[model samples]
Target: MSARSGPRRPAGLGATTRAGLKPAIFVTLVSVLAVVVAAIASAPFRSSTNVESLLFQMAPLLLVAAGQATVILIAGIDLSVGSMMSLATVLAASGSAFGNSAVAVVAVVLLVGAIGGLANGLGVLSGVNPLVMTLATMAVFRGVALLVLGQPGGSVPSGLLTPLTNVYGHVPLPFVVALVAIVLLWFATAETRWGRSLYATGADERHAASAGLPVRRTILTAYLVAGLFAALGGLALVARIYSGDPLVGDPFALDSITAALIGGIAVTGGRGSVLAVVPAVLLLSLTDNLLNLFGVFSYWQYVAKGVILIVTLWGYHAAGSPSGLLAMARSGWRARDARAARGTKA
Candidate 1:
């Protein structure tokens, strides 16, 4: 009977299975697997304390990733986030000299970050490429932070820092804050019309503009949100370290971008969620913790991280499926056609 019709599989099951294999889900699964492997390999070093420390270490990076993901979502990049964070920390510390007033510290830090983001947004909207604009701002902001706090030394009051740094009955406050931020971001990106417009703009800016979308304003707002989050992250850093160093966020800009990429946030944009970044940050933090436990040198760890970054990025590009499965299907069809032709010729 029609050659048994290939065993007569159910019609919708294949589609459902494919839907379950989304890129975000795949990346998350890989991240979980990596964590399990890390835990096993570093068994001797594993403990509740180490887990807590890993969560603590992931806080700043997660915050930065949360912001950076927004920028990348809009098909833009903010190379200045790290510098902005550093500048904010310095500003907050110096402003703390105003009698440890939390409001004053928060305001100063946010203002600095906002100014930096404004600069980035203006440049980008005015036709300057995001990369160049943010790079220039990175230098400017870092210079300003150095000028403000040359030696990288300022004390944050324990009263202001302790609540943020301490674990509340076995739960890290920063981690909890990060989780809240992720939930908020996920809601913003998924349940809001503005979020859909952001994706539309990133996916096809010309089309979005033609459709009367406020492309410029949307992009500007995205940068502003990123700036605000970076400022918050700077505040968290100050709390954790109990001091505001001028160079506190020197590596975060790159690391955050790396984390975002690893978390399935497509660099080309319009293809990911903020929720995806959590696992990425966790994976990186776990790897670092395991390395430290094994007494691996910092230099070697850096090399390993770089290698992982390259490999993960390659994997993302290879299987992103952003353009749909048509390309893959076409390749398969062409292969089949070639085989058929060979068979006929033979």
Candidate 2:
């Protein structure tokens, strides 16, 4: 009411931003706590060697998850990314055919990824469901990778692998690449007009289209970006393993999605922050690392990841979407009251 009071900020936008940010804050705290506990419990976890390895393990997932998060933001998913990564590794290992040059391999892989993404986008536009379209591509890409190299014997030039895995002091180069990508993507999703369009379109495609937000273009571009990121993940994988395995990327499709969900990216699409993906990825990588260090069976690792994902989903269902939770609770209460009335009559 003061005469000198400045124009009030938009309350709705402020509330939305805060709502979107809450999960990220919770996840960040959880990640930090997990790190601290792990370090205290296992001296080896605090070692520089293990720290470097953890970063190395996280890089590929970080790349793939960022892209996954992008597509997810637009209410679309790219199941083919793991296969795309597989294809990239095989191509990179097909020495001499690509002039034995790392650059050539990278270029071709990126092109393939973009083309694959374009195909997915076009398919979705043409009435194909995103899940089915990407799933089909997943099979195709993996088959192509196998055709390129039936076995995992092809050699990647040390030139490509060496620099990718190199550490500057305690930081792995691949982690740096992942971190830069996360930062850039965070900026784009949080700051840019395109990012706003992405959130709008994902929140409601029909409404976004009516608002003239270029919904189609945003969807197509999102898929293309996902493809490019998956290719980058493939390249990172090459550095980690120093060899191409047709099945090397098999786990990534699920892993990337899991990371995105765990990072607070809404399953329904339009909510959440990309910045949270960093800690989400770290949490996953750290869990796996600690499990291995503690001599847990590989099968148990899968069980642990599944449990974590389920818990995250439940938390979001219960806390993130208040309306849905309230509706469910109200329905349940009405049903209970009806049953009580029937019992009284009896």
Candidate 3:
């Protein structure tokens, strides 16, 4: 071998970084495409109100998906978010006299949500499968929410609206919240030791435990975070509609999970980012907004949304897998070689 010949040190990290980025990049492209298509199909989408409306609608889904991604990153799932949100709305609206202080109301709602989430973690730790445990909790929470409201006519304090939904002086409240959630979640997953432990535990529980990582604590933390965010979604709803409705958050269970998956948060666990879910949520919002502008029926929108999710998940598996990435690398190598050979002949 030549004296200077050696394996490139950065090459391995480069390959892994590229591989890790594939899903997020794909989702970003898809989001851009969705926006462009929406703009083209519906001229009204270019209007300021319409554009800002999309941002407002994107916030709740972003929060729920962010929370779900955290739990999924630890190889667990929370099926109770929809119910959690519903319960939050009910609690905030069920005449809980906090004496004109929305802060007090918010604190109580958040606390209850964290408690519910902790219960889910406990149930899982007690040998119950998360699928079953969270599902049961969902039913229980939904029943409690119903009992709290019995219907959808409870009143929410109007003062809470501004903090939750107001776009004042060029700064949208919901957008600010979304940005904060993205930054915090990203930092936790990418820059912190706990984040590393989350991935390790999700990747393989036995290995994570053998390595002396606190796998159970990580999972518990994920659930607590998920619950808190779910309640925040309810708070957003109160700001928007200013009333409690039991059914308001029912679709979030499926929608949030779909957003996380489409956002590049792999359902297989240990491999995805919360940052990706933000744009994924935008894609969904744009799709729905454009469909509405085009006079599409709600039923058709549901079908279209399902199709989009299925296709995105298929793409994730196809282009984000090890074999798929290896194939891409080989293709690049062949092209490079072909270019070099042509140059030599020239």
Best by TM-score: 2
Pairs with steric clashes in candidate 1: none
Taken over the whole model, the C-alpha lDDT of each candidate is 0.71, 0.78, 0.74
**What ranking of all candidate models by lDDT puts the best one first?**
2, 3, 1
The lDDT of model 1 is 0.71
What CA RMSD would you report for each candidate? Answer: 8.8, 8.1, 8.6
What's the distance in Å from true for residue 81, model 1? 0.6
Per-residue lDDT, model 2, residue 20, is 59
The clash tally of candidate 2 reads 0
- Candidate 3 matches the true fold with a TM-score of 0.85
Name the top lDDT candidate. 2
Query: Candidate 3's error at 87, in angstroms?
Result: 1.1
Displacement of residue 83 (Cα, Å) in model 3 is: 0.7
**Candidate 2, residue 14: how far the Cα is off, in Å:** 7.6
Using TM-score as the measure, name the better of candidate 1 and candidate 3: 3
Native-to-model Cα distance after best TM-score fit, residue 20 in candidate 1, in Å: 12
Candidate 2 off by > 4 Å: 1-18, 317-346
